[model samples]
Target: MSADEHITQRNSSVSGNDTKGSTEYQTGGIHDFKTQPNESCSFTTLKSNTDEEAAIPLMVGDVHLAEAQELWSTVRDKAVKLRMDRSGLGSQPPMTVHQMFMATVQKFGEYPALRVKKDRTWVTLTYNEYYQHSRAAAKSFMKLGLERFHSVGILGFNSPEWFIADVGCILAGGLSTGIYTTNSPEACQYVADDCKANVLVVENNKQLTKILQVRDQLSYLKAIVQYKGELEQKLANVYTWAEFMKLGENVPDAKLDALINSQSANECCTLIYTSGTTGSPKGVMLSHDNITWTASAAGHMIKLKMAEEEVVSYLPLSHVAAQINDMWISMRIAGVTSFAEPDALKGSLGNTLREVRPTRFLGVPRVWEKMQEAMKAVGKNSSVMKRIISDWAKVIGLQASYNTMNGVSSAPWGFTLANILVFNNVRKALGLDRCRACYTGAAPITKDTLEYFMSLYIPIFELYGMSESTGPHTMSWAEGHRIMSCGKVLNGCKTKIDKPDADGNGEICFWGRHVFMGYLNMPEKTENALDADAWLHSGDLGKHDKDDFLFITGRIKELIITAGGENVPPIPIENALKEKVSIISNVMLVGDKKKFLSMLVTLKCNADDNGDPTDDLTPQVVEFCQQCGVVASKVSEVINKKEPAIYKAIQEGIDHVNAKATSNVQRVQKWTILPQDFSISGGELGPTMKLKRPVVNKMYQEEINKFYSE
Candidate 1:
């Protein structure tokens, strides 16, 4: 029998007796639903008999044989559309991360696999070189006595070596755990100790310093491997990149291949730590099957063409989005993955984008926002004719965007003209002319921001998922784009709304092969996230449209209940306020169990031409402040004091927004100007730039109380 046939036969036996009422079959805590045996086999489902008469007895509960067959056919069609071929006729079944890497190397050994910037020079690595170097690293790990299921911590910015080290650990039959480069020593130690990592990989001396600070706390850590920079201290078990690779020179490739073959899809491959917006970070265990499935499904969704697709890797590799896009998906499709210079990304991502002109770009909302700001800054100084042309082009582009979002087939003549004369140039200037697909996730993006990019002929698909869901549960597919929705659920994934309210908003739940295994060493949390029925409760409140597109409203835990017994979703209101007020940096709606809603607002400061902080406020900036009734002479003063002018300006802005509120309880009754903006360093914003509401509420309890007291 073929491998696929054998897998089906094995699953049929493991499925046990067909329980009449059971909706799912449990095997080692993972549920596999029953499908028609003739249909393509899925790792997520069990095959049944194809004969109509014989299959009748296998139907669950009231499901008729015909109905079951029809349901299976529908699912099979969706999988086929997603290019998920389990029979391996046209496409191969999902492979583990290590297997995928090796397969890519075998097929595209001479093709450029990775590009990195080193001291103003671009360095390229072929698929073969990447494979050889990673194998060497894996051998070195084995030489260091690292065995199967052992954990290794990778802490650094995105780099080519980072990918090598990550895949090396997997090839050695070990779990790779990523630590955010921005994490403090305490946070680093927590992750390393919790995962019981035996080896720690650091990028440079700075990262090495963090490890040294918490070295004594990580009793399980045996070795430190530095990929860059000279070691400052002669500590035991310390090995530089050159030294580490040297340890594996005598080791055989057969040894690494044996270890890779020993790994199973069901075993844990990587431990991704959650951003911990609410509390301490928990290691989310994602099995090889979970990752490979996600990579395959997501790659299919985007329709990435092999050898032609390119992506810039800049986001924290610790984040699942970056890991999946830059690491897994790139490997899955044999695409080029470029590593942006860490320091350059903060101030000059545009330059890097121009240099790479990547075909596929994935960024968070902040990146899009910064690009918009830069464009606006240029427009502010442009000639009158240019401004007029730009504005007219945007009007045409907006109509086209609106038509696309509503599923219209044809665009007006003006859209074509604008695309040729204005939008196309704008795209080229932003280095997005070659970009075929652009995505934004990790946090909520405002509709205004999404539309703005859409107007520039760059459609930004807003996706929704968490660390527990591998990467993406729902994404705006190019064929059926939606303006504000998170698009339809991916193939092989099932979604349902639990306890929907009057507006049809409810906690979003998911059941699929891409759902993570569990939280490491946190069974209680895992049990809470994954129920007995196998549905993963997302804790996020959302509503699905008539077309089945999902729209996330807000976090269930962040929902505010007023003293007047009115429930308010703060995200929409906050998003609206941000759209209306440009100078507002951040706004937090606060009124939980209170008589009325209020907010804490922060102001954006003006910067000089060199992007340095400046005390001088431009005429436009001063005019905006004045329009809101603020009387600050300098931009810096807006955050320096609680002046009457600032309060009046804030109140004016609030009153303007309140006029559009649907209910009295949703309107802001009071407001305050925070002395500073919420930041990641301050513990008010998560790594993804999402506001940590609980942390913010606790830090400003006294200020919040004063607002309520009045």
Candidate 2:
């Protein structure tokens, strides 16, 4: 036979039933089944590129792959080699994403890997089925002309298709990029253009419109696939999910196998765009090693058990935190992940949580805060006797939680009774009854929110890291965690406080395999983040406690400098003020280049159907006002009338916070209540609800100037 004919014959050897067959998509909801242990399904094993491969692409988009190789090799040669005995980097050899997935499938082929709601039924996909679908998707991507080192931008919420597309992209030797569902058409274009996306997979026609609006500008975009709803327009190059999945049915298995085998652990496989609180989003390039290694190490740190963890995936997958929790960590430990409803943040999340009863839960600070507010509202409406009982139970619960956190062996009196009477019911109501661990991160969480949850016997631990570190560097867990600390560093990771002050607080730096392969196409930024020693310099300011617990103080960029050149961290003061003032919802301290610190405060108010803050106060705030003898129902009434009781309470709270300040400069000399609360729609907050200080400054520039002018 001729050489070309021989290669073609070899590629087509695998039968259609073996390579292209798919599990029947089930309708309605099916509950999770308990299959016998040792029940397993077959998974294909691909050739490992053990030796250096010459076929690996030299360039990915505008990034030179060799540059990343040199950078990580230096760290591997220096720190990794020297700390071989102590650090985790030395213990495990590097592996690609394919290897990690194979390992998981081998151990948990029959275990449920994903659960999606269809009508009222919850349908599940086993690990083996998940792998098979991803492979089929990979073939389709290859059939669509995806090239090596190119990208597939998945723009959607968390779904089965999202997971499949992401894994499929990586399997086909292309980069997987997630675009925030909230991104505008222009923003979508920027990411698509930056990643040189070969295909864009959107959740619905709404997102499809975004890509279509900018499609003319995206030179590299080859195909568009909508995972939900029918295409509004039957344009050329646009395909439905069904059509897209069928494109590669005729493609040979050997075609995808070749690309998978040519992959390396050191090369970038995914891009996580920073939410860009400080500026425009930058693509954070994470290598295969970064994802697989961090998944294993962090999973172990949190004590995730194989097939035992059940988690809700609702947060924006574009953020590294959600991606790690919903995708990587679950994949690593062979856990079941259920996708939350599309309106999760809009209030459907509670219903999903109640149904799933996840064994673990992760929420941003805002989510926890909202839950706290909802619970408080319910408590206020309870009968007199019930309220008395709940109040007593909460006190006992809080005391017990504190004792356990402090490592004191003696349980508080009535602790078990409190757990039965109040704590268990609270957990069940919030759908966290089976949760072994509940975590909060992506922004600073107030001690008030933490203590409130502790009062309910649900202590929310915090994890700290950025997109560049591939999700988590320091984590807080159940066994060994301080109330406000971000916990100790992960086993294989190292942290350093650069140039500490008298209190030992400084910029936090990370050294680990989790550090990303630099920002794509931004060399100056890459140099700024990773110093000469290869440590990823987190712009976040933090300090270590005597017992090695990590406490994040503030960010270097967020620090406010006075005219006298004294640096002041704002969050601590803001948190303190909010705690003291029950009616206050949000506060931002402003004193940069000023004589004294001032603040812009927002009252707790009801949100309209559109989620915009209305003029009316929330129920909790109204109750607070009633207690203060104010009798106000709206924020406008309190502000326009200058209600004495309300203003007096605010003054008292400010005074209480100022009394604890170390210096006169730290005191709030002047303050004003914003007519409306800061919100994501208002452009004062990021997608994860993190405060955007720069945006806030610009929005409230006129109000801020009034304080200085006086």
Candidate 3:
């Protein structure tokens, strides 16, 4: 055979003898443990200075000099390493998604790879079957003339088919773009057109209807493949998944082998669109090298165990956070991933958690907040004895969490008793008994919420990253974490604060192999995001302590500047206010060029009926009013009337927050409660439950104006 054909043949089969360091598992499959390159493929390793002792300079601005220096004095000599080396993990990183997938299949072929709900039962896909099915899908794409470097769009909720289609496109040497399932048709059209995707795969008839609405505008769209449901309208260029897979039966494996073998690590593999809080979403181009390096680095930071970990897939696949944790990192670690039912996530996530008992779980701040709220409700309704025990356990847990955050190992005898009496049951009830690591990111989580979970013996780590950095750049690891800190930079990543203000807060900039290639077809925007030296300007204001833990203050553009010219970061104040007052669902501080700071607040309303607030309020809402000694049929009435009792409570909450404020500009001068809460469907909140500041400000402009006028 010719050299090219030899390479193609070697890549096609799972024969152990052909590849170096290939081990034959007892389960009757070949697993390659070494990071060997195919004859036609090459890989790149990120450069690092592992052995050098770099100076730990205090990068503090004038405003933070005293505090920074004081913190620095404690850990200047014994601080944990800020930048860990990937090489120190004792393994060569896989270069491409295909490489990682093949290695995982080789290592755990008979092990369950994916589990999905089928009617009333769960269906499992083993590693061997996953690889074979992906190959089949790739063959089908090749039959459809999917050329190398072309783009394919996947629009759907988290499902096993989504994972199959994504890997199929990558294995076929085409880049895949995921469109948010909750996005409007116009938004979907923008992503499909901007990426120039030739084929779009959607979940069901509803998703297909979205494509049909905008199909006329998609010039490059050649075909639409539906993973579920039959052909309803019989539109042109629409194919059912069964039909698509049948198309692959005629195509040979050699074609896919050659395609996979020709791939390079430096090439772009995926385009993840931003959430578009500021403007239209930008397509972030991420190379295979970026994903692989991030997976390896993050795995090292969190110490993910291979074949011993499981994770639930519920977060939108369009988001990079889910992609990294559920797809890339899982593949790298050869771990199992279970898909949550599409329509049942909100009602069944807790049940699913108990069923899966995932060792690693990733949740946004909202999910954690809901869990905390549920715990609070349970505590409220429990008997006096249970409440006392819970409170006592919480006190012990809080102390234990504090010690853990400060890197101290000792715990009092009461802590062990509390763990057995209350904390352990709490963990089991939340289905986090087996969870080794729980992470919250995508937005800032309140310190109160973090400590609440910690008191339950479940430490929730805060991670920081964006689409431009392959999901996570900094994360609070298990060994060394601090309250309110996003932890140190990940292994193989470098972070710096640029143009710090007097308060030492500045735009958080990062440089590493994990940085994205650039925004798709938007060179000017990409240039604005990345500087000449390749440091990504994150557009987030943050500060770092002497121990190298990162603390995000707020968004640079969202900072509220008072008429007196004092700049106030709203996030900390908003978080503090929410922590103090449980009823305030969302808060947006306003005072840009105004005399004083004011806020537009929204109340948390849980009606007994989903659509009828007048019918009855939830027990928790009623209990809150009763505890405060306010008599009202609806929580909205108290807020709308600004009733003296509730108003006094709110004012006391605000005053308490102001007491902790460092300056008068940071204090809330006034606030007005909205009739309803911010929600994703209402456009006030992003898909991840992050408040869209611009949208919210415009929405309550009239209410905000009234506050200033009064």
Highest-scoring model, TM-score: 2
lDDT, candidate 3, at 489: 84
My TM-score estimates for the predictions, one after another, are 0.86, 0.88, 0.86
lDDT (Cα, tens digit) per residue for candidate 1, span 310-370: 8999888899989998998888778899888775435767888888999989988877876
Q: What CA RMSD would candidate 1 show?
A: 8.6
Model 3: weakest 10-residue lDDT segment is 63-72
- Which of the two, 2 or 3, has more TM-score? 2
Q: Cα lDDT for residue 145, model 2?
A: 92
Task: Report lDDT (CA) for all predictions.
Answer: 0.73, 0.80, 0.75
Order the candidates by lDDT, highest first — what do you get? 2, 3, 1
Model 1 Cα shift for residue 106 (angstroms):
1.8
Candidate 1, run of 10 with poorest lDDT: 69-78
Deviation from native of the Cα of residue 547 in model 2, angstroms: 1.0
Tens-place lDDT per residue, model 2, 1-710, is 11111112111111111111111111111112122112222322211112222211111111011222134321211111111111122223445788778877887899999999988899999999999999989999998999887899999989999999999999998889999887889999999998889999999988998888999999999999999989888999999999999999998988788888777666788999987767778988888878887887677777677778999999989899999999998887889999998878878999999999999999999899899889888888899998999999889888888888888888788988888989999999999999999998999998999999998889999999989889998898888799889997876666778778788888888766688877888778888998765667899888888888889999899899999999999999999998888789889999999999999999988776656678889888888888888888998889998889898889999999999999998999899988899887787877788998998999999999999998
Candidate 1: clashing pairs of residues? none
Clashes of each: 0, 2, 0
* Candidate 3 residue lDDT tens string, 161-276: 89989999999988889998878999999999887788899999999999999999999888899999898878787999998888789887787898887665556778899878
